[model samples]
Target: MTDFNRDALGPPAGLVATMRLLLVEDNARLAALVSDGLEQQGFAIDRYESIDGAEHAQTIAQYDLLLVDLGLPDGDGLDLIRAMRRRGNSTPILVLTARGGLDDRVAGLDAGADDYLVKPFQIPELAARCRALLRRPGNALDSVLTAGNIVLVTAERTIRVNGQAIEATPREVALLELLLRRSGHVVAKPALENALYSMEAEVTPNALEAIVSRLRKRLAAAASNVQIKTVHGVGYALFAPPAADE
Candidate 1:
């Protein structure tokens, strides 16, 4: 059995946002432990115990990562991994299972798993591995994101304006990262909601508005050249306003 009495691990360095992860594992205790552990490291986990449930969930929501176990109550997890790859899904997959044999590891990798971790592993190592995968070129968690005078370092989870650091809550930072990534493009409301909240969070109707308002105030106080524009009944966009001389 995996140890459940260990201390909670610290958040990994360079975590960009509250990445959403889908975890497929049958053992109830282990699933809960894994979910709790990853959530503490600044991830939002949506868990399922079977292949059918996992497949259904994916159709409804986009996930940043997939954590799958080889042995499941319904079928082998390898089949699920193989099917996803065949369908052209490139979301990073990390295998978590009791199968520690060399052959099992090779099979998992060949089936398109980016990484494999045997059962009874420490949460800290698992968190570290996830960050490593996200750090790869072209992945979502880029090292740094910039918009006009505002700079955000994903690895350090710090925001700066004109090289001076500014205080921001985690939610504010997450919103800023999303805006900076698609700067000048209108990001739909639903998309922003998904990036900012997890499946289990009880978000009120005006929660998104409230977050946007606070972030706007913070940016203005920092004297950032970039601005967030509400598209009025549609969505929001971030862009630098034209200079007065222009």
Candidate 2:
């Protein structure tokens, strides 16, 4: 039996918007375990048993990070990684495999994987490794985000308005992080939905609206100069309200 190290990973602090991941593992049992564990740690996971499914998914959606197993049914995971690099895709990839040989690790890295983790490892360590990769410069998930009077520190899961700390629910923090990162531009509704919830989550039609409403109230009560404007049938945009003098 594989030890998941769930206790060590602990509960994810819902600090930033959920990071989406593509997991390519042919072992059904192991795939389920990894996906569930990561989801508990605030990551949205899309699992595929083969390279073909994963390739198809990439065509429609973007993933923050990829967890791939070397032994796939259709092809080698390294091939997929190499293809992604060849096409100029810099999305971070972490190789997860049972092959622990030194040469194997070197090959994985040479093929463009940012990190490699041998199987039968602790889930906490895997989660930490994923965070390390995402922290690398130019990744979609940043450590800190700011807009107008709002400042959010993703690492610490803290948000403040004009230096005064403000409390926010996990969902509120997730929504606020996405909005703050793309401040002044309308973030499409589907994109926001993907960031806020996992594929397996049962989200109501009004789920996003509820989160937006709550975050709006929090900012208002904190006297934030920033505002979240609904585009109605489009999406939401966060921007600083124009100065009174203007």
**For residues 1-246, what per-residue lDDT tens digits would candidate 1 score against the true structure?**
222211234335555455778889989888998889887777778889889878987898888889999898889999999999999999999999999997999999999999999989989788768866665434344668877888899878799998999998877788888787677788898988987776446778988899999989988998888989999998889996654522
Q: Rate residue 186 of model 1 by lDDT.
A: 88
Q: Cα lDDT of all candidates, in order?
A: 0.82, 0.83
Worst 10 residues of 1 by lDDT: 1-10
CA displacement after TM-score superposition, residue 169 of candidate 1 (Å): 34
What candidate 1 gets wrong by more than 4 Å, as runs, is: 1-16, 136-246
In order of appearance, the predictions have TM-scores of 0.52, 0.52
Model 2 quality (TM-score): 0.52
